[model samples]
Target: MNTNNVLRQITYEIYKQRTVMPEKMRTNYRIERANGGLLCDLWFLTVGCIHDAQGGCVMCNYGKGSGVVHWDKILGELKKIVERLPWEFEDFLLTPSGSMLDEREVSKSMREDLCGILKGIRTKRFIIESRADTISEEGLDFVKKAVPDAEKYIEIGVESSNNWILKHCINKNTTYEMFQDAVQKIHQAGMYVTANIGLGYPFMSEKAAIINTVRSIKDVLNDGADSVVLFPYHIKKGTLLNVLSENGMYRCVSFWSLAEVLGYFSETELSKIQISWYKDYFGEEKSYICSSPGTCPNCERKVLKELDEYRETQNPEIIRRLREYPCSCHAEWKQQMDRENGQIDIKRTEEEYRKLAEIYKTDRQLLEQEIGIMKDEFMRRYGNE
Candidate 1:
């Protein structure tokens, strides 16, 4: 079906509508509990994700604010941020808007320069994020050398274990085998690996989303991941998810669904799971996020509080409490999950594809053909059920 070509065509059409702008980016940091101690989480801006230029993830808008790369300006700002930090931290996380290991995003010389600026920080564990394909032995070795004093951890966004969902749904362009290979490389380098699992993709039923996420979590854990991070769906501007939501074909994932997914694991597994982007953290700018996971106005605040507590404590009892917590929307969410029609609706999906074809001026016949193929494949896979 040439899914990449289709996704790229739509992505380029959306990109044409976007205006490039330069704004004063800020570095955000926060202290949180992890591994029985305080962990410092820090995020900085860079040239942005390289994949965004070629039809990136459906739910991501990380590359929107970025334009061209100015290494001097970015490194100078990072140095200023590092200078302001305290002498020591228990665990330090340095996250960039894009994959730090991608040379196109952050060149080798620039990485060395940034590492020079960060080498002085005393930390027990140093964590960074990268895409699975970019996680080479050289990159892992460089990070180990750059931060010799601390234990190294690389986080890769393995959004789903299902290759079909990874390609047709999220447009991630990564496979489960690629993720396993990356994890093995990291482990061979004597480092830790964390997998980031995403929930709430378009055209996926609530029950299917939860089930897929749970399976993904288990897959990564069994593949030697040291921890997992759960990222609930956030509708961001300038992405395919936003387009779907605007057209009434999508809705934000409910917080209860996240709680339900967490409940499937024991306290030991739960301890290794951390929820992020459910709500804003580090006082970062959220103007780009149209909506995030939530239940209702009545219980939103309390649910968020419990989620935050769970993030900090990793206590299974909190999830149990949330399961028992009363809310008017809970029943509705349960009903959606318990419904028999738990697969993607091929008819609605084809309609949306047709609408996209008209709006983006693509080939209507080709989209129809692709959708027909997808429908047949779905039936062949699930008809017996």
Candidate 2:
């Protein structure tokens, strides 16, 4: 069986065990800097990611807080939250637990109701997120009609530009071509694109991860991304990454690696980039995050503090200072980066999959059959791409 197939099977098996609890709504509110000013960012829990139910990305554990979704209650709560916000916020970002455009996760009625609430807000810019495949002309038209005066941005996750890496390493099941198509549609709708890029995919050295991420950033920008958001890999509980970390096969992206990626971009390019999921700038849910990007204990706090400040200010000088900051771990990290190949270790990956199957008591034959069917469909869609 192909390595991607095996990994996907393992992911599906693990994800199948998740228990859906009764309805409960959870929301997180934060004040962040965006479009050169303060922004009100609101995150609401939904049912879950539809992709996740079908064995999603290797590193993602989104919608962990999701329960049985109550759309009316969620909208009501959202209205109350928006009503309570001070008039000082010039920008507003509404992020659901999953793709806002995927009706299975967030229904059209809920979105229409949510848009009604947004239409009443006084924000200058309105932002929302969706998967590349979920973006549609109808949805964009509805949003544009609702917030006619606000600058609109649709954030999409394009983790990497390399299809092979996306398939075998991250298992994102999203192609760069799909992202390009989404970008074209968003641009046609007169909306800005915020491409979300992930750093530190498993089975690569820090140096290789940095290179891949930098390449992805450049690719997205060239493909018409108005801005980019860098999400340094977070090891979330119950995620494949967490399993790999426990088995000593993976580590979160190092702070040094993040600095290296930033170093590759000029100050002007850096202005269009935003770093996310670093050391707890957004009041990250502790129950979800097993670990985030960091260095040693000696410099971790100082480094993260500076990174938080940089995230808010987007100052190139802060990145320069980070590069110059001295630490013993920096030399060690560099050595590992230089010594290791970036390729995935197929042997170890397969062994881990087998072990997971054993531990989870998964039916190997049935899983293999499912993977075979998936492989057939994948090849049919993207043959020799």
Candidate 3:
């Protein structure tokens, strides 16, 4: 079967389960201060990301969905979770797989019903997800008229400004132009725009990833997005990334790498728009899986605590301070980065061996023939060695 059919099967299997918990749906909630006050950040994960279902990105396996779920049931489950929230959350952030506003995922009636549901609730701001292609005036109108009391913001997962990475590695069909147009439409609709920039995809150096992400952030903001969210790539179990990692092709971004990216942006640059990391969404655990930046056992907790503070504060000084902290494992992380960039010491050593073989090739048996034999053996054992 093709990728889409495989994804469909996976989603079908998930929906076949008995009851889908909010977390099972990949939904979770957090309380954060936004929109000038503390708000209940409620996230309900729908089946899987729609883009992922349609032969999605390489580094993603979040496509597991329960197929076509009843929108009212989803709303009911969401309402219960909201009511049960302990704090008085004034803002409600609704996140769904792929584009929640996508008609195929959330029908017109579903959007209308969701609007009606929010109309009854007292939310100050409603931040929702939408792919650039899925943004619709009708959907916006439904949300606008239904929740007249709340501010509406649309977040687009532009991922990166580098179309190369988006098309080749990520396989995201959307383009920068499409994203910009979506921002324009959202602005024209009188709603706010938030650009979600992804980091750490294949075929880019650590610096390149950071630079492209920063560029994407600026591009989206310039195009009319009011804020930006940074998502460092995480390795999931069944994604293409996992396969690559198994085949010695990909590595997860280290904390040092993330810090490097964060440090690249000045406070002035970062402050232009509201910025945040996925770490703020579901905590450190959710932000990464295996192959994390190896922090020393002694300072790991302290480092993570400080990192979390920096993520929330966006204080350049915080990142600067974190970057300065001495860690023995940083050398390992640097070496890992080098390996990822194809700068392995073995490659250099292999080059030196080739040079030596060239120099000794004139000798009969002492150096030339023996060196040639060794080179052949080495190359045979470790290609190009």
Candidate 4:
């Protein structure tokens, strides 16, 4: 979506209003105070370090096949960017990919050096991403020593608390115990944490899965994680989800349902949280599974409201056929074709998306072509074209 649009402004607006770290994870420094300087919170690094068997992103490929990304050339460029970037903000963030951050042993020195470079910057906030299993007292201790006084935010890829849900559904390796252990250690060292979670992974009953995901996030927040990154699933071509998309497997919950859940979060919980790219995946104003005022700060509920009005207009015609039916997401869901051709748009209403907090997908580009496609599609679908 055009960054200049009011809808797009949701992102910067959220960033602007977010005065403190989120509920799940937080830093010693107030995110609010530094909001103006966030433009300078540049992430300097190579994207080739991480690996996701399918690819770096859930939807696209970005690993071994993505050409060569040497650590030296990477670091050299990183140092240059760090130097060239205005030394304005108290600090900047270092966001590595699932593959880059997941690399071990041979990649250790590079990772350490990357941290060293960030520390040398003298920024007030320094963050890194790591799988739950990769964190340990030893490595964190080393990082602490190298970057003392900087509030370290270790992003734990604890996509879900349910092991079976994570392993069988998302193919993630880390377990809940591992997540707990990492959080414990980070807290012991007084470091901050941001646990990343996938709200509505496929194959699970939407209601059960969403409730479980929400509770788990609350559990971590209960543990005082500085922030929680709730990434809903997004369906795109070339993914298992994409394959299942035709079978209606990609749809999880509606943004409305997610909003209901967030609305129910305790007030003490509401003010403490912040969001990251709440709706960037679509590059436009679109509907995601999750869309509470706080949860999806980037989505302003305009297009979604349009979709809702479409459904409401179909209610009478839908009930004429279902007879015993009440107005609902399912009544509307079953009549999708009808909704499209003037039969009635009822099917769009009954998607029952509230079962999970939200559903959305993000992709990573391994080449100019792939990036262009995603970027273009995002812009086009959202009206940039």
- Estimate every model's Cα lDDT from 0 to 1: 0.79, 0.78, 0.62, 0.47
Where in model 3 is the C-alpha error above 4 Å?
A: 1-28, 32-39, 45-47, 86-91, 120-124, 272-294, 331-385
**TM-score of every candidate relative to the true structure:** 0.92, 0.88, 0.73, 0.58
Model 2 gets an lDDT of 0.78
Clashes of each: 0, 0, 3, 33
Candidate 1 total steric clashes: 0
RMSD of each: 2.4, 3.9, 11.1, 16.3
- The local distance difference test score of model 1 is 0.79
lDDT of 1 at 261: 92
lDDT of 3 by residue, 65-180 (tens): 65656555667877777667655445677766557788777677766766655655566677887888888888778657756878887888888875544654466667778888
Shift of residue 267 alpha carbon in model 3, Å: 1.9
Sort order, TM-score high to low: 1, 2, 3, 4
Give the clash total for candidate 3.
Answer: 3
